[model samples]
Target: MFSSGHLSFKGRGEKWNSTDDGESIATEISSVTKLEVLELCGNSLGVDASLPIAEAMKKHPELKKALWSDLFTSRLNTEIPLILKTLCNSMIVSGTRLTVLDLSDNAIGPQAIGALEEFLSGPTCFALKELYLNNCGLGSAGINVAECLIKCHEAALRHNTIFDLQVFVAGRNRLENRGAKALAKAFKTLGTLVEVKMYQNGVKQEGISALAEAFEDCPNLKVLDLNDNTFGRRGAMQMARVVGKLTKLQVLNFGDCLCRRKGSESIVMNLAMNCSAIQELRLNGNEIDVETAQKIVQMCKSLPKITILDLQQNCYGRNWSILVSHFQKPFVDFGAESDDDGSRDGDTSEEESDKSDED
Candidate 1:
């Protein structure tokens, strides 16, 4: 019975869905003003729909955040700039005070990615905390989003504009060695980022290792998502090795990664033993079995760090509790009894959280 105020669209009995569902959310938001957060995912609403929202937003002038993440959307074969025309024209993208934008799994052209350079040059993007362009077409083109970020960071520095951020999850957006280095270079300079997700990009071991080095120097980033980026066992071990050096990481998702179970376990245990800073661990879809779970348990112990654990769609069962009991981290989305057998518990099924919180 809600339109634009606060709406949660979901199927019955399906718990632990990610709030990234942007589809089928039709709110009578025309008259509403002073919106705090707007999360509509996969709704197939182009930039035109944003005109009304933008105009209304101009009046409300209090809209803090808006998430249009479409995790399941197919890549747009066009270039990145064309896709972003709507954002540049009428939308919350260039607005001030707006934070957190997840445009994951879209095909964004490189030129389009670069076009944002002009946008970021403006004062609008100063307060942005998270800007997710994962799985976007930026990777498809010879261009690299990591490079764009680097350019943006330099622009911010040159302009002397205040920029602070916590999360910058924009992976699965094809980043090769040069591009990854650009990101790492930017990180080395800025100490604001806390969590960075870069899984499924074409980052090689060398590139990840570079990022690890940058992270070690940066002093801020905590959580990292580098799963499914073609990081073989060696690459996973190497990337985890990078994180092991970082003591602030709280969440790490290595599910269905290129690395095998052994490699992943090594990374997890290493985080638990050495880092002791990680809290949330997501290793779902990696095909880890009871044996692997046993190893994970022996390594993971009571610490103030670890919390929410996701082992769903993998191997662990209800008995898996024994391993996670030492730690206070609550387990959800275990997928032990899930009919889908592919879903996880407590995990954001979609990109943006359907859950609207002040944060």
Candidate 2:
């Protein structure tokens, strides 16, 4: 941690959980400024410790990234928003260089989201690019989180500032259909996203349909992970239709997403027809049979760019090899050249084959 571009005090044990420990560090490094990154997670440091650190951070004129996640347990209900505002104001006063903010695993609920409303609504623009709010107790009822992003988008656009956000991670937050709809609305307003992770959010057909419509706005999207969600046939079909619009998508993970034959066909057929750049596709445990597996193999073969295709834990039985063999095509070359000369450079082993295989 000495003289490095990043600093971490996470999981420092009970000894450094006290306010005195924080004050001592702050005092010792009060003159040091301009940290590129700082992480103080899992310290259980209460408000008293946070205050000193926030005060010390005021000297960092170019603090680009910071994380104080899981710093409190019960105090998150009241302190989450306060600490956010404090850090925001402190950065603004010093110099607004923030890009990523992680507040995950904090047990944050509606109140904390509500608390962010004022900050998002403020005239000061924040150049945030990545936001991580995973497992923060924002269930199906918590639409304020979506609203906060909407406000941020609106404010940044009106002010002509950079809201070029890319990655948004809210996985395991239990954001069901309604919450997904709210986020979709926000997505319609903003379009500079690249990756989105919303695993295990309990989103169904209605929610996924809304998201499918919103996918039209994100043309630069490359990675999308919606695994462990129970979107049925209708939802899968809707997603397939819209996902094809993202021609640049390379990685897609929807394993265990409750897809039947029709649903899986719709997805694979659409991707094969429209998205040819996809490299990795994961549809494990989707109840796929031999017919569905054959369709998947045909679709995969249609795309020359396909690299990894996962169909494990499905109902393909012994016939799963039919699908696996498509992606396992042996490397071969038609042109044959033999360097049988003993004068060849670095030919130390006689067991080496003269022929080389190419894709």
Largest TM-score belongs to which candidate? 2
**TM-score, per-candidate, Cα-based:** 0.63, 0.83
Which ranges in model 1 have alpha carbons more than 4 Å from their true place? 1-30, 46-62, 71-83, 90-95, 140-144, 158-161, 176-178, 232-237, 256-269, 282-297, 302-359
User: What's the number of clashes in each of the models?
Assistant: 29, 0
**Where is the poorest 10-residue window by lDDT in model 2?**
350-359
Candidate 2 pairs with clashing backbones = none
- In model 2, the Cα lDDT at residue 173 comes to 89
lDDT, candidate 2, 1-359, per-residue tens: 43565776766643344568668767744655547677777766555665676688888766666676776665646766665666566666666456777878877677667655654444433577887888888885357867777787777777788577788888898898889999888777788789999988988777888888887899999999999886677678889888888999988888878665677788888889989999888886566665676668767788778787776566645444544555444221111112111122234221121111000
Q: Write the per-residue lDDT of candidate 1 for residues 16-72, one digit (tens) a residue.
A: 122222112223343454455665555443433433444444444355565656522
Candidate number with greatest lDDT: 2
